[model samples]
Target: MRRLSETEVRAAVRGGVSRDGEISRPLENDATAIKCFGCGQMEYRAREVCRCGYYLRGQLEAERQRNADDYLSRERNRFNQLRKRRNISLVAFILALFLGGLYVTGNLTMIGDTLARYAFLVSVVFVFGSLKIIRELERQMVELSKRLN
Candidate 1:
C-alpha cells in the first residue's frame, strides 16, 4: 500500500472524499462516496470515511484488544476456580485432621465398635484426597503465575 502523507490523511478526513471525485461502484449507492485518499480504495463499510489501509489498521487494533481482553478474562476465571477449589481442599484437610485426632485420642471408642472402625479410614481418605487436590492446585497456580510474566 502507498504511504499517506499527514496532509493527505487530514484532507481525506476533512474533504470527505478524494479530490478526483472517483466513486467506487460498490459504494456509489451509499450516502457518502469518500474513498481513501491514501490508497484510493473505497471505504469497506457504508459509514466509513477513510481509505482501506487505515480502516484495516483500525480493525487489526480492535481485534488485538479483543484478544487481550479474552486472555485476561480466561486467566481471571481460572484463578477464581483454583482459589475456590483450594479453599474446599483446605476445609477438607482441617476436618480430616480433627477426625484423625479424635481417633488417635481414643475418642472413637465412645462412638462404639462399628462406627469407630470406619472413622480412621474415612479420615485417612479425606487427608489424602485433600492433599492431592492442594498439590494439584498449587502446581496450576504456579503455572498460571508464570504465564502472566
Candidate 2:
C-alpha cells in the first residue's frame, strides 16, 4: 500500500472525515483541535487525547485539576506521592548497601550475621519495589512523548 501523504496523515490524525476528495478534521464550536496522541485521531474527550495507555490517566488528572483549586494543595499532593515512592526505593538501596558493607566487615556474631541477612533481604525487596515504580514512570513518560510528537 502507498504511504499516506503528509497532508493525509495529518488530516487523519486530526479526526478528519473524508469528503470532496479531501480529509478535514473538525473542531467543536470552531475551536482549534488539539492533536490526539492515541490513534492520531483528534477527539474532544479529554481522556481520549492520549494515544498511549495513559490517555485515561491524563483524563483522570484533568478531572482532578478541574475540581481542585490552589496550586499549593495540588502540588503538595503530587509531591507527597512522588516523595513517598522515592523514599521507599532510596531506603531500600541504602539498606542493601549497608548490609553489603556489614557482610564485607566480616566481624558479625551469629545474631549479627542473621540481622545482616535480614537487612539484605529487606534491601532486595525495596530494590524490586523501586524498579516497579520506575517502570510505571517510564510508561507514563513514553505516553507523554507520543503527545509531543
Candidate 3:
C-alpha cells in the first residue's frame, strides 16, 4: 500500500470541487505505487505483486521460479566445466609423477636422453595444467563466498 505523508492524507480528507463541478473523494491506501522491476516504470502494487504490463497473472511467483531455474542451470554448467578441468589436471599430474620416477630410477647410460626429454614434457604439462585448475578453483571459491554473504 502507498504510504502518503500526513499532509497529503489531510488534504485528500478535505474534499474539493473540481472545475467540472465533480466532487473528489479522499484517496485510500489500498494499493501502493511502486517501480516495476522489469521495466523500471511506476505501477500499482497489489497482493505483493507489481501490476506492470510486462508480467501476466501470478507474475511475482513466476518471476521467482524463473530466477531459481536459471540459477540451477548455470550451476550445472559450471560444475561440468570444472569436472573437465579437474580430469585434465589429474592426468597431467599423474604423467608428471611417472616421468619423474623413471628419471630418478633408470640407468643414466641406457635411457638418459629419452627419460630427460619425457621428463621435460611432463613437467611443462603438469605445471601449466595445474596452474589453470588452481586459478579456476580460486575464482569459484570467491564466487561461492560472495553468495554466502
Specify the highest-TM-score model's number: 1
Error of 2 at 127 (Å): 2.7
Estimated TM-score for each candidate: 0.63, 0.34, 0.47
State model 2's lDDT. 0.57
Query: Model 2, stretches more than 4 Å misplaced?
Result: 1-76, 107-112, 134-149
How does each model score on lDDT? Answer: 0.73, 0.57, 0.58
Model 2 per-residue lDDT tens digits across residues 13-98: 66554423434444533344444545555444434434444364565567568766565465556555656665676666666666
If ranked by TM-score, best first, what sequence of candidates would result?
1, 3, 2
Better of 2 and 3 by lDDT: 3
Q: For residues 33-121, could you state the per-residue lDDT of candidate 1 as single tens digits?
A: 43455676656445433534455445545766999999988997998899899999999999998998988888888988678769888
Query: How many clashes (backbone atoms < 3 Å, residues ≥3 apart in a chain or on different chains) does model 3 have?
Result: 1
Pairwise TM-score winner, candidates 1 and 3: 1
- Sort every candidate by lDDT, greatest first: 1, 3, 2
Off by over 4 Å in 3: 1-57, 107-149
Runs of candidate 1 with Cα error greater than 4 angstroms are: 1-54
TM-score of 1: 0.63
**RMSD of each predicted structure:** 11.7, 13.9, 10.5
